[model samples]
Target: MFRAKPTFVLLLITFIFGLIPWIKAHNSSLSFCNRTCASKHGSGGLTLPYPFGFSDGCEIKLNCSATGKATVGEFPIQFVNGDGIRVNIQRKCNRSLKTVAQLFGPNYAPTANNAILLNNCTEAAFPCEIPSILVQTHFSSVSCSDSNSTISCYSERNKRAFIDLERLKKERKCEYLLSSISAESLNTSEAPVSLAVEVVELGWWLEGQCRCDVNANCRELVSPHGRKAYRCNCTEGFEGDGYKAGSGCRKAFSKCNPAGYISGKCGGTTRIVMLVGGIVVAASLTISLGLIMCCISRRCLKWKMRRLTKRHLSEATGNLNIPIYSFKDVEKATNGFSDKYRLGTGAYGTVYAGKLNCDEWLAIKRIRYRDADSIEQVVNEIKLISTVSHPNLVRLLGCSIDYGEQILVYEFMPNGTLCQHLHRERGDGLSWLIRLTVAAETAQAIAYLHSAIKPPIYHRDIKSSNILLDQNFRSKVADFGLSRLGMVETSHISTAPQGTPGYLDPQYHQNFHLSDKSDVYSFGVVLVEIITGLKAVDFSRPQNEVNLAALATDRIGKGCLDEIIDPLIEPHRDAWTLWSVHRVAELAFRCLAFHRDMRPSMTEVAAELDQTRRSRSWGNSEDNTCTPSSEVCSSSSSSNVSERPLNFHKAELAGRRELLTFGEKSHVNLAQHILRD
Candidate 1:
């Protein structure tokens, strides 16, 4: 060996010591990256691989139980094959389209390989890959009663292998998913093995820039939403996830190449040359990384400031000295207006149930129109409703009128609307007493609007659907979009008639004169709906009886009230019940008069209804002494004095007595007659 200088030898030894740890750390990282993911069996004996794991570091995290069962959200994994996973979707008749939309994620989505069946579409023009009869037979769980529904199929053979749910909903107008299946398995000639379980194939990929090992390859692709995406694969003679952060590429063969140190083909000079080249490459990488980090930091700052500026601008534009919420806050509360939170849709807007950041639940109405006229209407509603306050009125909690959105927040009602209880299959039927109470409370709310407020507000649209009910089943008047402030000097405001078809006041419809009496006429329709359990407008009924108000007018005027009364209330046919029902029916007849002047003012209507409810006798025995208030009794007695005859003749008067005496027996006959008709 040659003798070396003491100082040079000392420096060499120190450098060698430093290199030892660096080499060890580099080797350790490579070994860790090369280690494979421990294979595990999930639910339905499905094996979970690299990208799908139970830990946070996984590209697609799945919920795993202690027993090795795995699930993505509420859906269980049926099988895992290559880049696709099949999840078994349970058949449901009323499953929301939002549920299927929720299945999409950053790393995985329903692939274009699936043939999706959409039901209850708004239009019948969508292309159908399978016949509607076949869908009805195989997917028997779904119910699409609309004859115009197209029962469309959506599938595409393309590289963008995931379903764009939002696009599908927007373009097709389909709100319900009947079923989905892999295109490869679909055949018009034969039925699938299982009708109850639909297998949807979802393609998954690692999201973000490729983090492949040195020996792996990266392939770029476009996501369903047109965003850049990528996938990694091990090069020839290697295997594993190919990601540096996952199970990196590993050699498949046991023998090493001739270029490697293990083959004993390299000398000391070669080792020195390799070390110098490695140093230069490492220096270059360090410089490039620092420059990239600087650029990223500047970009991040710009983005943060831009968001802050936009939020500040929104806040400044909002209403001051009021509970003005941010659009982003409202959007987050309603989950970006997801259909799952939607309560109902109307001509003007859709209502969604939202839970705010303050731990308060609210009903948010998102105005559908964005025209200048619609914006003015939104502002008018805010101004008019903010001035009034009542227990029976839907309280406006706040509003958000930013980012081209006009949204109003109100106190949430748990029991939905009066229309739902009276028409749709909601829950146990409303008792006769409850209906009476609802009618009374609703009348009081309308009275408050007509009389209590200065420049009295005329609710031009007062259908049963606009009346919301609270947890206690108390009525609250809602939807002030068509409401207008009356001119105290004038009898009525001149405007185009704008209201629901069946409930619209005929006088107003012809004259274009809007007044408080218009609401009274609408309320009369609601009252008739309460007594008869009939919709305001049903074209399916006999042509002459299409309008419920017209039908009630005919039946009540002809002394045949038994023919139209709801069979549901027939069981409550005590003497008091008979008398009360007749009184309310007579009041409804007066309200539905063709002439607006003939209808009772909301004040008189509220007082009479309140008195009728208070005077009810629970006992089965007849109580001739039980009577309405003096005002209502006087109105009833003096009805013959009015210009328009009260429609009730001697036969109708005698019919009332028969109703009181026959009670349950008469109602039984009426129910049988109704069923026969």
Candidate 2:
């Protein structure tokens, strides 16, 4: 051997040392690739790829059943691809979060392309994309029917693919894993086709640092627990596993031959130039075509949706005999929904005073949000109102479901709402007689909903604001957006509590059990408002008196009824006025009972209020000027009332006796004594 220079010898030694590790790595990779891990066919003809096989020597062992179904754990593998695998997890009503926790492994985890829905969660800070009705339909078991329980759907954009299970458990006190939806499957509508099987993408990776081939890319991954691993993907113009130990990357086949170009065969440079130009031209045309197709598809989708909405509206209102106005007409009627024409805004929509083409003044309600929920509410109100024939109920004149708008037209009430009269001074103040009449009429309307129909209907939202007053001060219950049809066989419908804060039934709020009594409870708050002329929920009041119902209940319970009575009615406190006021207060107190069973039915309540109004009429006819302390006012009414037997339940009789005892030491005693006789 020839003697080498000092610099050459030093470089040679350095190169040898670096080459030793590379040689060892190459041999190890060769041995790993040579090791046999036979692949198998799975259900739906899915292939079980290397690194995920049924036998030993595989990175991730799969369980292949006799029927050819492959599973990693509880999740069935739907398909396997070069980059990842798709698994299906069947959703169950009672599938626990702990069960889903087992889905994570050293080789695989759910990718960012999945959105998880947590059912019956205690804290649902995440966005809820799934409709509650759809969830109810899929998970109908009693365990999943807790209306008070919340459902949360979790997803992140431009973040790590893996889900942090520990963070979810700590942050969201979720009880069950409802389902998972693919990110690709979701759309702008936010409505999925099915919830039965949740398809989740699990990105698989090898356990150590990346050992990718020359033509592959290495992607570093950190698990939910912060363990590091790496995945390999073949670079452009290549295919296969991308890992040196696996099949590794190989050049993808193409119509153009590299050898022919290098050898100057197959028509030489002119042919090569034409091929390149043709590819560029084809790609440009393809991109332009794709854009045009996308635009056409979007427009077609919108057209289809509009047509479907019109068809649905026609079918829904076919037998209701209500007209469907055009959106252009409705917009013109409200002067393009001008601020001056706007009557008032409520929780779900804004009402505008619109004059129709027929010279009809109507209240047009334009739902604030054009969403499925708002559309459903419009349909619900139309169906419920049209099914019943009651003078005390608001009349649905027509609706417009055009141009993606949900507009409801109703007969206008010139006098506005009872709440406006009582609290906001929108119109002339209501007298005690007018208030009582409104109360009785509202009761009749609600009673008709609860008892008149075969299946029965629940006016889930009952408040003074929903009680509209006409020209003659007659009350009509409006805004049936939250109403529900009750079943004849069931005692109560299980549903989430929905109503104004102060008017929501405490029992319904706690138990999620809705019944006719729930409406009664809300109406009781309205009763309190009528009696006190105070806002149902007023922050200006003292903390303990914030809720008018609570304050009225406390005062009435202590026999301090006069303290909470409306001052406007005080000047007219004759013997009959006092007695009738106390009686109505007593009725309201019963309606506000904490237990649903203790609350009176709407029918009973309507009858009692009617009788109280009749009693006041009888007293007025006899003598309008009699004072509370007058012998003529006291003796004559007592004798006349005692002669007629009232249809009072035993509970009412007992309640009356208790009231008499509580008021014996105060001025309320005279009213209680009159009520007792």
Candidate 3:
């Protein structure tokens, strides 16, 4: 009997394997019903439905009329002579031909909008009448005859089948507009069943459909070939009642977690065995790999940080230390350059009140080397400033060039930088007249550099902080760190991009080519700042809306220039003063034009400022120097020049001397002449 046990198991396995195909076929029916996988004539989703296809192969055209022709939705529909049924295909609503013979019939027109009528047809043979075209685009009427024979087939011999002639005739006529048709000869197929019949009946669909099948429900039988339709009750976990007696949906076994399975069949011992096995494997791998890497990285980080820290500390604090001061010397000065004894820092460097060897009060700039591209630049600055002399330019007293440090001493300007008077609030400041005077002095200084100096020095970085106010409130142009001297022949020089961001010239920013016009642009930005009391680069607002120059220009155009003008300067506004200020703004705007060629020369800018000052009676003192010499020269110029004796020989000698001195640089001057001669 024990030997027979193994044979019994083999036989059982064979029986299950043999039933698989039948079970699958039965199960497919239980899972996906006719409604889920409707015939090709049935509508699916999207465009046209499946099976019928879209072109001539289908019984009905996808979007065509009943006659199967191209037509819009609302129109007279052509008809095909056959039973038709309306069905959803793809996502759109459509009609389809049920029979293969009907699709190939003469009533079907491949090019026509809908089907056309065939002669000699009766209502009894094809009960369905063809739909009238009315306004429908794809529908058509069909004609059928009474002599048509209905074909029927059955797998079971005992089951009698008969065709309804009257219904067929009516349906064929109506088929022109309908979607799907039931034919006598067609066969139905289904998938296998897996579960007990009683469980399938408890499904939601069966519970709703079967009043008698609350505990056990009946489902409609679907045919496979031509056997009689049959029904069966559903089993547990199955949703719908089965169509056949024994075949129905079966509960699928959950193999993922056997103990937690709905049909439970496992234990805690198996789970613990797997858990321990996984932990041992994971820990062994992790410990071996981690220990090896940890030792290597721990040594590397310490060495790297020590090297980086030493390098950075040297750069930050090594060269920036102040000179050693004896206690007595420090006490004597400041009253030791004390808080009260201090003068404010300007563009040149910090200004401190200190007592020198002669016990003289002087403002000392303890300059540290900012960036002396080369040791040669330190020599160049010392040589350049020592040789050049201009009344309006701040004078360099003495320099200490030691090690990597360079210091320049200058006479004190007690009142501080022009930025404070123009931009500072509170009581200690200049009035309107003094402000105008300062602006005039600053313009005169720039003009002197542009026209009077030999080979001309451009104060490339010009801003309010660089303009220092003396005790007399006179403007002195200071700070030569970013300054450059142009040879007479070279009008522009290539340079690295460097400057305050907002006040930087657009041309210089784009091309890194520096010219005198770039200075004009920076000055323009500063002038706007003076007038508006706004920062050149303010990012407190939104990211998209930057650019102070464009914003101010927009306000000026709107006749709301006063809205942007500093409140401190508001009380000084009058018709003539406003005109003069607007004139300056206009010049500044021109100076700030994107194209360097469009901006006025620094000489012209100075001339414009001088003209405005004179015309407005601003700073008219003898020393003001804001008056235009052109008016005086123009009125008496022609007769006086002709009357005076000519110095032609002297002029000739001077011109020759100048040419020889300029040498190759003369070509640079000629280039500028070609541009603006």
Candidate 4:
């Protein structure tokens, strides 16, 4: 009973010792061994095979989100189709004219022959081809390499010899070559386009030592020389290539010859040995997998418990009538307020697109670092917004004040802000009809706040940015943190002037009296924005035209409103279109009047817009034909634009007289310019 068989004891010891090194090598070379097996899909949702996978078998590591957004290393990939890939200029090399391939991703090399380089220099010091320091600076035709960091100018197309990069730096007098432009470029083009691509796409498909056939499984063996040996085996139900490439893999059935077929059968002793070896390996692997799974379960349970505790605490302490969510709930919905979920940011807060449910999204405005004004505004927003409900107004769904964070949740507007549309950032420009409709709808909403409410609400911040559009392109006014409730008895609210710079009321600024007319003035500015399709406050303009309100007022006064109108709307030159446009101009002109008393109410403005839409102004009010210049009114009535704080009473009287006179002098010029057939 005590005696162990000598042969069995030796066999067991040998197997155990041999298994240790095999296991270590196998673990270390899992990636190398399974080199051709697909690990992941590339960015842009292309299934990455072999050379493009994430481990030792692949040349590139790529990840793609469900939305088809892809990324390579630290750079967000614009696209990836076969060997060609597009990545945005990486953050580090965004301003750098000389960029490296590493910033885009591994295996990427510069496509230097197709890039157009531009520089930010005040003046050109040398005789350049482009002459503006915008590309073509020291143009001798250029090219680059995957390993070489210095970008040099070459003498001719298809030439390998490069001009010394250091020599050009000392010779040129402008800012060093600006960053490469364009997402794509042709290699055959006369000039170079700077693009980055994988230096070689199919470098990882070859295997080392082991010549594995297609669909073959390979493993590693540890050797005494501290080297690894690869062993290939035909997948189950197959034969050959179990160790090396001396015989390639074949189907078990195909291995037989029909004439002299003999099934490769083993003796009883050999079968028993093979069975015992397989059982030992399988049992060991199963035990190891079970241990791993158990450890994972413990972590999952701990996380689940913590989540349950948080939910329990949120319910017990949060005494809110409005739907209140836990900090964790908000975090999970927005993926911890990730930048990927962000919709836009403003002075008040950053709005993130959060999934409260799988079907719908909520615009979660998070004010993480709130100052005193913002905190007070959040409180005011909650109180005021809760009481209001209008189709044109954004609905307040819920809020969270957990962990010192002020978060307001709103019905997500799929379409972005009106500003994005007005600026033509949404691919196409809004049609004239759509612009007019937006103006009318926005006016109606403001009119509702001013006239329909018991105590009228003054929307102090009535800029295009605050106007959000829905899926159907229907507009709604949002961001009520700057709103003030008007007292029915008081003519004006005595407060410090607060509104967007370009849209702020001039009268309010002069007198510090915020009235319903202040909102009207801002809306008037928006109307001008719609009409001109220009920024209300753009510093990238001449001094006189820096402020769009002032510029529009100047242009309208000079009887040259046609000159300032957006080119997109220029095709509509019908009589009705002209008359409607003229009427709209007059309305905008009146709304932007210097005095609050002089400005029309939002109700009157809304009514007038609707009426104009109906009439289309085929032929009415010839007085509008006058030069339409507010500047002319200033001159005739002895008023001056140079006059700081215009005399509203005098200017108002002059405006009336100017309208009555209408285009006596400049009208002829305007008729020629505006009503050209």
Instruction: Give the whole-model CA lDDT for all candidates, comma-separated.
Output: 0.70, 0.73, 0.47, 0.60
List candidate 4 stretches off by more than 4 Å.
Answer: 1-321, 488-495, 616-677
- Give every collision pair in model 1: none
Please, what are the lDDT tens digits per residue for candidate 3 over residues 31-99? 432212223454442232211223444323334444433221322222211122222211112232232
Q: Which number leads on lDDT?
A: 2
Model 1 scores what on Cα lDDT? 0.70
Provide the lDDT at 616 for model 1: 55
Candidate No. with top TM-score? 2
Candidate 4 deviation (Cα RMSD): 18.3
Native-referenced Cα lDDT, model 2: 0.73
Minimal lDDT window, size 10, model 2: 624-633
lDDT of 1 by residue, 472-586 (tens): 9999999888778898425654543567767878777456677888899999999999989899876457656767988998888876777888888762355346557767887
Q: Write the per-residue lDDT of candidate 4 for residues 1-677, one digit (tens) a residue.
A: 33568778989999999999999888777645222222145333444433344455343555544454455533455644433456554212124434332333334433323333423333444422111221222221233322223322211133212122343344442333433333232333332223232221111112246567765786654322234444465788777644343355667784334222223343434356566676688888888998999999977875675556446434533433456665678899999889999999897789999887556999999985757787778767776677677788898888776656778889999989889998998748887777787888899999999999878888889999998989878889999998878883266645445667679887675566777898999998999998888988764566456578888776666556778888887624544465456557767887888777878899988887875564433223443232222233222323332311111233454445222122324323223222111
Rank by lDDT (best first) = 2, 1, 4, 3
Once model 4 is optimally superposed onto the true structure by TM-score, how far is the C-alpha of residue 358 displaced, in angstroms? 4.8
Clashes in predicted model 4: 14
Give lDDT: candidate 1, residue 637: 23
Which 10-residue span in candidate 3 carries the lowest summed lDDT?
195-204
Candidate 1's C-alpha runs over 4 A off are: 1-321, 488-495, 617-677
